[model samples]
Target: MLNIKYDIVGSFLRPSQIKTARAQYANGEISLAELRAVEDEAISDLVEKEAAHGLKFVTDGEFRRRWWHLDWLKEFDGFTTEHLDIERGGVINHIELGYITGKIFYDPDRSHPEIEAYDFLHKEAGKYPGITAKKCISGPNMILVDNYLQLGIKEVPYYGSDVEGLIEDIAIAYQNAIKDLYAHGCRYLQIDDTSWTYMIDEKFLQKVASLGYKKEEVLDWFQRVSTKALEGRPEDMVIATHFCKGNFKGNPLFSGFYDTVAPIISRIPYDGFFVEYDDERSGSFEPWAVLKGSDATFVAGLISTKNPELESLEDLKRRYAEAKAVVGDNIALSPQCGFASVEEGNCIDEETQWKKIDLLVSCKDFI
Candidate 1:
């Protein structure tokens, strides 16, 4: 029999106080230091709640940024903030591309944002010493997507000035970032990635085909990039890849099935894969066999945060069982995504968010 372990993928569940502080920061009423104080208090409360819920792997809930991962990377170099194009979605980003600290950090020129968000995760984890602390970061490839296309930077870097160099730097930077978190005693890492979804998009797919690449070739690209980022890391490190379909406000950017890119998704292995199977928009779970790794674990997203309706335990269990039918029993449970991928959060409130996690905890037998 497979030894099934249960855990939940972590994300920021925004609190009311943090929202007020954001307005204060906007109106110039609170200095950055003051803002930090408010953020600290919110994180303290969030950590307490997770403890109350008995979650073994706890996160600060990504409270640091206004957007999902982009907001968090304001600390990196070669980036700057700018007026966002209304059509292209993004969070608060480093203004230009000059501040990139490397594949993982910024230059020691004191250019990095002096925010304590990531470390705050350490503080809360230490407080609960009983639960494992998880740190979430945008997957390496996703950073490349958000940086170049969303911001409309057409120029290439001189180091290589092409896709190859770009991907290498992303992997390198992630390693550095992971090292920093590990030094602070973090044992779990989840890379939030939406790149695969983009690859399967109609427009982007046409763009790749325009370059004379075959469908199989594009799929290989996803596997290679994802694998490159996972390369040469500590075997004991609990690294997970989140297969997301974009979360902005309560809106989603794309959706499809794992079969579209099954070859690579299944081959480029990781300890666990966090996937969305909450609705048919994600198609059937048939491709999960492709995602199956030897001794590999899976976090089945049976609870959805997009809608406010709290899924019934019976209904959630049915969904979990459906995934098990294909992968044959190596499955876990979590919401399709965070209660709040951005500041506004997924169309739900704190009450509903807790109810969702509570459901996961309640459905332990299925998980």
Candidate 2:
């Protein structure tokens, strides 16, 4: 088994300027050269801040991508954006609120439409000296999940023909993207697969089951897409998967434990797993115990990134003790989810975010 010292899910929140630059460049208002300059400065600042906190692993905060995972697919060669009417999620018991339908392409239309987006983020994060940078990719299964659900997508974007063929092309496109990211020194690539956890919800499960899929078939769907997309990658390099029901609107989509999905997760070859445990909705420690004797490092989500209210030292310690008892000291901790899973910051403001970080540092020894 691979043993690691210290317990840190090291990464940071993205800065705002990168978004501004991407906009200006996309609208043809500024040259790509100008955007690169902005990205360079922004990435440098991001690295410096992460290092200042004494973080061992760092990310560029996904400085180049707009949405965390989807945008990476946009960088693949066979992808094109086409709008299809996809569903929007609700608040609590997060359901499909509505659809902000528009045309989108399935292609990687951003920049360098050859491979994946992670290596570029990794490269940007690498520019900073001395910090071990990380790259986060949208899990291949995530894109397939979005396609299958037709989530938030509008039907007919700029790619007006051959829809079925295009979907197959997308899967192939992602395969190449994953390979390219691996080639570029991405020893620490985290596939952001939050969608899988959302699948265990009763409402959604009922819907998919209505489509004629049984429990075994649905479980196979999860394993097939996830493992196939992750196939043929390097073993020594770490590839971790993260799942939270949903961080939108301070509402969660499902309230179940790893007990439901742990069997599927344990069978996968991923080196580590990160899960949310910040609220009662997340269920109990038994979810992780399923991976007993497994090498996968479980980063328990003991802290909440959505609410500004800080988790007191005592409470966090107690939570960790419980997790340690169940999963042993192999567990690490991170904010329950990304502070900004989408553009809007979580209910928490920037100051509270830093305070939480300070607490994480204070308890480094306990880790």
Candidate 3:
């Protein structure tokens, strides 16, 4: 079980400096090195603030990239982003999609930008004692779910109709990536995934059927890919998964409960699970009863990052009690999701964001 009782879902709201620097880089007003200097300063300050706030871990705030998942996904071989001419209405229409042009593989000899980012975070975090620099990456299932299941990019000559083969290759690529990260001194890794929640969404279920795939089969594939990715993971490395309904611009893309995915959640080989429960859309805590006696830590995301209004202390304790009744003593607390899953961020202001973080830290006293 993870010794820490309070945690964060990783990404913090991007500061104005980063936003301006990125835009300058895009418009050719600033060089890439100049933009990186701004990001470096921002991240260094972020690590100091996180440590001062009493957080056990710190991230680079994902400041280097635009979209959380796409930035990391595009780094892998055979995966590239493309603009689609066809417009699918709803949340899918807002974002860029990825395409698999060849077999997915991770060449260890090549330099990875994420590794370089992690190296900087690890160094800054080392300045403060007892602080671990945690790295957050998109889960393996994200690529398949977003590209194939949602966007219907089903035709890939390499895997051609062999869905299981595709999943295996993705798993292998992720396994190699995890090994590489461990080598880079990343002991705490969080897989930020929105796909698990999609499995329970009604609209997403309809889309699954429309794609000629059964809901159960897709769940199994998600589980398989996730499990295979962690094969032979180091014992000292702590791997956790954060599951939230899409978090884009203070809005959720899908709505559902954890009831349907509880069994699959129990089956995944993660050391912990950070589940969204900040509002009515998450449903009841009864589903977590499936994990009552397990050693894995169940992080109840009882605070809301989307809303600025602070959660009442009494109400937070009450809800924590409700979760404790079902999931036993192994539990932690965090905001439902990151302050910014994308570069746009949630609706809350930075002052309010830190206040929420203060509340998160305070809640740990009772736990």
Candidate 4:
């Protein structure tokens, strides 16, 4: 079993230097190498901060990319993005929709940017003894949702109406990517997914029904695809999935209880689960009983990354105790989600973000 006591959901706020460097690169003011140098320095600094704050695992803060999921998803062979006039936040204002143009596949011969980024992170975090470099990628279900379900496209060029075929291909692509990352020295991997949380919303379920699909089938597909993607994972590699309720511009996109989907989520063969419980919107901790007797570690997200208000230690301890009552002692602590799911980040500032981290570190004894 994984023994991590305190953790993060991955993706920290992008520093100003990295943001400016990206703009300069886009406008042709700086070359790709120059932009990378800036990102390298910023990531190094972020890793140092995470270590200094006493986190056992360190991430590059996902500093190099704009959107948490799209940047990684679009890297695959068959996926593409279409730019739209829509914008998300004030700092970095751009929106794009992803689509599948061809059969999804992972070509091992091609260089993967996320793998390269993990190489840098692994080396940098290696500087501090006992610090594990964690790599966070968008989960396979996100690809299924963004490319097919959300677009209301039941058929594609290659798969046509064969939805199960599409799911299998996505799973295979992820399996290949996971294997590739493992070869690159990634031991701790986290997959961030919002589809499971989206399923909790009635309207989202309605949409699925409107598209001639049953909610139960979609849930089963999510579990099957997730399990298939993790096929052949080494015994030492620890994989976790974070179910986020949407963190954009300090606002949440969905809110409801996890009761309906808890059993389905518990069935996925992940080593750990990063669940959001920062507010009343998440409902009671009763649903966590589904994980009872399971070996998976449960990271209860008690602090809110979307706001600057620090959580009271006593209250946090109380919540953790409540969760432990239902899920047993394999619980860890973390913020509800990443500080920034997008480039603009939540409404909170950097100082506030670190303060929140400090609070999480301070609560390590609860485990």
Computed on alpha carbons, the lDDT of every model, listed in order, comes to 0.68, 0.63, 0.89, 0.88
Instruction: Residues 289-358, candidate 4: write the lDDT tens digits.
Output: 8877889988999999987888999999999999999999888888999988888889999999999999
User: If scored against the real structure, what TM-score would every candidate get?
Assistant: 0.86, 0.80, 0.96, 0.97
Q: Candidate 4, 298: how far from true, in Å? A: 0.9
Look at candidate 4 and give me any clashing residue pairs. none
lDDT of 3: 0.89
Best candidate according to lDDT: 3
Q: Find the 10 residues in a row with the least total lDDT in model 1.
A: 93-102
RMSD of each: 3.9, 5.3, 1.8, 1.8
List model 3 lDDT by residue over 1-367, tens digit each: 6777999998899999999999999999999899999999999999999999889888998989788898888768888887655444444545677877778888768999888999999999999989999999999888888668867888886887778888989999999999999999999999988888888888888989998989888888998999999998999999999989888778888888888888887888888999999999888999988888888999999999998899999999999999999899999888899999888899999999999999999987798
Off by over 4 Å in 3: 84-94
Clashes of each: 21, 27, 0, 0
